[model samples]
Target: MANAHMRKKEPDKVRRSLLDRTAKLAVDQGPAAITIQAVATAAGVTKGGLLHHFANKQALLEAVFADLLKQLTDEIDRYMAEDPQPFGRFTRAYVRAAFADHKLGVRSPWAALSVTMVADPGMRRLWSDWLDGHLAAHRATDDTPLLEIVRLAADGVWMADLMGQDRAEPRDMTGLEPQLLALASRPPSA
Candidate 1:
């Protein structure tokens, strides 16, 4: 009976292992490099074992995408919890989280999974749905232009760093956070 209980937990472990391996491959070699056999080999599991957890490559990539969104959402939530101001909390938290991820050498799953999204329409729809839901949940009350600008700038900074375009000796992307936050704090102009 104890063994049976333990067996139930094993699948989740195996699933996580497979997803981690797939994410690594997607980061290191691009999503094109992710295949059932390749992921299984990278994860030290047989192809059958990987398939048991993920019905196919699409399923595996979907899981990876979902996990990535969850991590980002959780990080943003943590930042929001620390921020007192309600007006700019979402954009501020987003910028801070992106910088934190870069400092920690964490690769965004969206970069890694882009190929899968391009290859599979279903994956794109899944991602779109997730983003739509996230935006709906975190919708800003004021909807100021500065908030949009700050978010766009943050995305540009993140993309530049992700693509190795930010050639500064010390990455100080966070330096812009205060300025953006200031803009976010102001009331919309008449």
Candidate 2:
């Protein structure tokens, strides 16, 4: 009975290990390499063990993508908590968190999950829905061009960072942040 109880707790660890292996494979060899056997091998688990945690490749990919989204949302929440502004908190938080993640290194989990998301339509939809929901929450309260511009600029910076383009020339965006924050704080012109 005690052994059964202990076994129940082990699945979560196994699942996490499988997900980490999938992300590493995606980062090293792209999404196509994320087969069940590949992930199981990478994780040092048998194929049957991997399947016990994730029924199939799609399930595994979905789990990884979902985990990524949760991490991003949590990071954004942390950043938003630091800033008291009500109007642009979400966008600002998103920008700050994304840039921070970029600095974590090139093979960040977010980048690996991005590759998987792009390769799988279902994963992409999951990301799109989360993004749309976040934008809707902000747009419902404030519909301003400046806010949109800030969102776009932040997205551009994030994309550039994700693609490692910024490393080529090292364009600094620190000066632009305060300016964008000021614009986000301004009352929308009637």
Candidate 3:
């Protein structure tokens, strides 16, 4: 019983440490440098120690992505909790967070890691599935073009940043926040 409990606790600690290391690597040098050995070294662990928790580099990267997804999901949750009346508040918060200061906020990790998907379709699929689920859950209330537009606009901003576009201006998202709130808060079509 003691050994089992220690095994459980130790793995969680190692897993968290590896994730923190990977996120730092991702932010610093981008996800392309996120390797099992690299993360192990960064986390002050041996490769075998990292492998004990992740089994492989792909698994570690997935955990990194999972960590980012959870953060974004939690952000959404907190925003929703503040105003549970209509889902618009959730949507508005998303836009504000996404484009606030013309930056992707904490979601910058997702954009950085997204490039790795070209080398790993499974990672791409995982992200796609998560996005699909979110859309489906909102489809009923969204039930119209407004939600689709928001999704597209949000994606456009990301893509623009990814492509290094030099638009008229970065985005001025702060100015657009109120417009997004108005659109999302409007009563759904009868």
Candidate 4:
């Protein structure tokens, strides 16, 4: 059943704004800043309005995490579509997407979502479930040691950025993507 919020004009627009604001807040202030009142003010909505869209802060956080995952999924799919190779295609696409997604703004909310994800067990489960399913789906092509290593390397870079351990200057990592792609271009070396 739908609610009054769903029946309003451009309700999805409002909902998206709320989610975006929530992600921004998460990145800027950490998970503790995702309160309903703060999210409402960030979205330029009333507490009642925010509540109408999201039952509670938890619900809103779940929705935001889910939305961010959806965006990443779409990005990976886009990269796969453009890729010319078959073997390790998924791995290659994932590396490009993950590195590209680490940016702070311009629709990139991974760092923020990652912070919230670490604090919430349920959200972590959501991520694990999604990752398990995705990896299982791509296992045929991405199971090789080379591809796995490449993917893990990409993860390491992203993780470093997430932990504020190292600045991810793409230029500094020059030729890195090509090297990964070249490795991904091969079949099982094992």
Candidate 5:
């Protein structure tokens, strides 16, 4: 029977799909585009189905933000895992991930959410919380002013690219990572 091949509905799968679509919408249309009707249409699910997974639009937005942050933290961890050196390691990984995310163009949730993160206090608080956690964890290695400057520079470059600034792209500048990593690699002054 044609109907026999159909798989049973899975809530987890459906929920993940909804989240993925929400991120995509944010990437394509900014956070303001994220609504119950819009996300449902994007996810190809019924309004009721989307609501089942997310009780409201605000809940859906928070879930999307959480999902994006998880993906970012995982990438940072992955990058950190590959580097043997402890000094400037997190900064290096963040630089790489920031530039790499930019290359993904409109599909990268960070690109769209950057503005929202700055515009919305709740989103900004989440971002600040993430930074606070990482800062606490890496204080031993990343407490120096030099490391802080490097991190701030990386943030600037990332936001610049997102804002469509000419010549803001790291790839276009040539050896940007090497330069940033060079600074990050230097040991803190005694």
Candidate 6:
């Protein structure tokens, strides 16, 4: 019984260690640097061990995206539950959180994963489906047109932010939050 318990705990420890190493490597260098051997070395495991958990680079990339989405969703869900904000408020928070990095010229790991997905048609399809669902959900809300505009604007902001086109000094959007909230409260389009 004691041996079995230790054995069970060992895999969990290894799995977490692998994930931590992968995240650190991803943060330090980009997804392209996340080879199985590199992850194993960073995690102090053998390549065989890494492969045991993740069959290949594709699987590893998928896991990374899944983890990232779960984290973002959890934070947004918590905020929505606490405040129940208008659409603009929600958009502001989403943009601020998603593109709030202080460092300019740094390539986003999220974008790196997105590039990886582009190479895989299945993942591309999955993302398209997910976006469609999200858009549908937004359209179903009370302030449809205003929220839609806010959503579209927010996407442009994110694209610029992600693509490094927004080279201007990062302005504090602190005051704009309230304004966005007011705009979001507008009635849906007829």
Among all candidates shown, the one with the greatest lDDT? 5
In the order shown, the candidates' Cα RMSDs to the true structure are: 4.2, 3.7, 4.6, 4.2, 3.6, 4.8
Q: What C-alpha lDDT, on a 0 to 100 scale, does residue 112 get in candidate 6?
A: 56
Error of 3 at 184 (Å): 1.7
TM-score, each model?
0.78, 0.81, 0.80, 0.82, 0.87, 0.71
User: Cα lDDT for residue 134, model 2?
Assistant: 84
Candidate 6 weakest lDDT stretch, 10 residues:
96-105
- Residue 182, model 5, lDDT: 89
After TM-score superposition, the amount by which residue 24's alpha carbon in candidate 3 deviates from its true location, in angstroms, is: 0.7
Q: What is the lDDT of every predicted structure here? A: 0.75, 0.76, 0.70, 0.80, 0.80, 0.61
Candidate 5, overall lDDT? 0.80
- Which ranges in model 4 have alpha carbons more than 4 Å from their true place? 1-9, 103-107, 165-171
Summarize candidate 6's per-residue lDDT along 26-48 as a digit string, tens digits: 76786779899899888776777
Error of 3 at 34 (Å): 1.4
lDDT of 3 at 187: 73
Tens-digit lDDT track for model 5 on 63-175? 88888888889999999999899988888888888778767766778887777778877788788898899888988878888888888988877776777733444346345
Q: Write the per-residue lDDT of candidate 2 for residues 82-183, one digit (tens) a residue.
A: 988787788778767766765665677776666556677998899889998888877854467788788788777766666764466766666766676677
Those runs of model 6 whose alpha carbons end farther than 4 Å from true positions after fitting are 1-9, 85-93, 99-108, 117-122, 133-139, 165-181
Best model number under TM-score: 5
lDDT of 3 at 101: 21
Q: C-alpha displacement of 96 in model 3, angstroms? A: 3.2
Give the higher-lDDT candidate: 3 or 4. 4
